[model samples]
Target: MGSLVYREELEEDKNSAFTWEVQANNKAYNRQFKQKAFLCWWRKKYKRNAIHTAKYNVFSFLPLNLYEQFHRMSNLYFLLIIVLQGIPEISTLPWFTLFAPLVCLLTIRATRDLVDDIGRHRSDRAINNRPCQILVGKSFLWRKWKNLCVGDLVCLHKDSIVPADLVLLASTEPSSLCYVETADIDGETNLKFRQAPTITHHELTNIRKMASFQGKVVCEEPNSRMHHFVGCLEWEGKKYPLDSGNILLRGCRIRNTDTCYGMVIYAGFDTKIMKNCGKIHLKRTKLDHLMNRLVVLVSFPKSLLWLRFNPWPGIFLMLQMWPKKSY
Candidate 1:
C-alpha cells in the first residue's frame, strides 16, 4: 500500500509541473488559444485571460449564499430558535412562525448579494469581451481580451487599453518608445513611457519580423510589484536585460504612440493589477457586528422567560405531592 501511494504521489507531481519562464511563440510550451487542456499534460499550463470576480453563479447561488449568511451569529441563533421551536415540549410558538421570518431575512440578504454579484459578472464580461488586435500569423487580427494567451504578440494603438502584461517589442515612435497612461491602474494621470530593447527595436521593425520572432523570457513569478520588473529577453543567441521601463502593464492605456507591438508575459489574474486586486472575502462592518451582538442580547431575555415559565406547573405539582413530615 505504501509503494502504491508513493507511485500515485509521483504521478500527481508530474501532472502539476509548471514554470515561471515563458517562451514567446514556442509551440513546445506555449499552447495555442482555443486548445484543450487535457492534451497538454507534459507542457506548462498557463492562466486564461478571462477573470471572474463574482462570488456566486447560477448553480452556486443558493448553497453558497446560505453558507456565507450562516457565518453570522444572529442567523445561527435564529436557526437554533427555529429548531427549538420544532420540539413540542420546549416550544412556546409554532416552528413555522420563526422559520418564515428566517426565510424572508435570508431571501432579502441573498437578493442584495445576488444583485451585486451580477453586476460584477457583467463587468467582467464586458472587460473580457473587449476587442484587441493580436498577431494570428504574420498579420494582426481582432480578437477578444479573453482570447489572449501568454507569449502572444499584440498590437496596441493610441488610446487603447492593454489587455495583459506585455513586454514592449517595437513601436512607431522613435527608438521604439511607447507612452501609456496608468489612470486605471494607479489613479495617476501622468503619462509613462516604455521602451523596447535596442536589438528588438532595430530588428523586429515590421509585422513579418514580429511574427517570426521567438524570444524566451526568464523572470520571477507573478507578484504585486507594480513599479518593479526584472527579466531577460533571450533571442537569436543573445540575451538582453529588461526592467520595469521595458514592460507595459495590464490596465494601462496606450497614449501618444500611434502603433506599438508587445508580447504578452502575464495574462488574466497573473497580471499585476489583478494580483493587487486580491481575492474577495466576507467583510462585516462594525455596525454589522454590533447588530449581531444585539440580536443575541435581545434573544437572551426570551430564552430566560422560557426557562422561568417552562415546567413551573410540574414544580408546583411536585411541591403539593411531597410527603408531610412530623415536626
Candidate 2:
C-alpha cells in the first residue's frame, strides 16, 4: 500500500510539470495564428473568414423550397390539373379561371415559407457568431464558433453556450463537477451535471495550473445516441475511462461556474444536435390524402362524364349512391 501511494504521488508531480510545458507551447502556437486571422479579414469583409460553408444557394435553394411544396398531395393534385391546361379542349374559360385563383393561393403560401426560411438562416448566423474559447498558453482566447475544430481545448464560462461536443477536463468545482443547461436541445429546464475524467480531474482547475495539460482522447466516431459516448483520456502515462458523463455537448448552456476546461471531440454537423435532427419532412394531413384520391378517381372518368353525360348530375348521383355517415 505504501509503494502504491508513493507511485501515485510521483505520477501527479510528473503531470504537473508537463502541464507547465504544454502551456508554454500553447502560447507560441497562439502568436503564430494571430497574424493569419487579420490577413484573411480583408478577403471576407462582412462574414468571418472562418465561417462554415453552407449547403444552400440560390439555384438549388429555390428548387428545394419548391420540392417541399411538391411533397403535399393537395399541391400535386392541383398542379396536375393545371398541367393539362396545355390541351386546347381542356383549357376552357372556366378551368382557366379556376387555375388563376389556385396559382395565386399557392404563390402566397410559397412566399410565407420563404419568409420563415429567411428567419432560420438568420438564427443560424447568430449561433455561428457566438464566441468560443481556444486555449492559448495559460489563458483562453475567444474566436468565432465556426472556427472551432475537433481536438481543440476550449473553456466554457458560466451561462455560455457550448460550441461543440467536448470532453470535460476540469472545472471550478474541486471535484471536477460541471453543470450545463440542455433546454434548447432536449426541452428540459433543469440543469445537468457532468464530471471530468477520474484520473486527472483533480490535477488542476486554475487555467494557469492546467496549462501544461496535454491529453490524448480516444473515442468512438460520431453517432446518433446522445448519451452513449465511449472513450478514454490518456495523460501523463495514465488512462481514464471516458463516457457520456464526461462529455459536454454543443448547444448546451454552461451553468453555475466561472469556467470549465474541456477538449473538443466533435464539431459542426457531426455534433449530436445535427444527428438527432436528420431531415425536414413536410407532413401530409388527412385533407391531402382525400385530395389525392379525388384526383385519381376523377381523371379517369372525366372524358366519359364531361363529353357525353352532364358532369354535375353524374357527380351528384355518385355521391348519393355512396353510403352516408351518421354522427
Model number with the top TM-score: 1
Output the worst ten-in-a-row residue range by lDDT, candidate 2: 16-25
* C-alpha local distance difference test of each model: 0.87, 0.69
Residue 302 deviation, candidate 2, in Å? 4.2
Model 1: lowest-lDDT 10 consecutive positions = 11-20
Tens digit of per-residue lDDT, candidate 2, span 190-285: 989998876667666567766776666655656567876666666778767778898999789988978788877666766777778676556668
Score every model by TM-score.
Answer: 0.82, 0.69
Candidate 1: stretches off by over 4 Å? 1-19, 31-44, 295-327
**What TM-score does candidate 1 reach?**
0.82
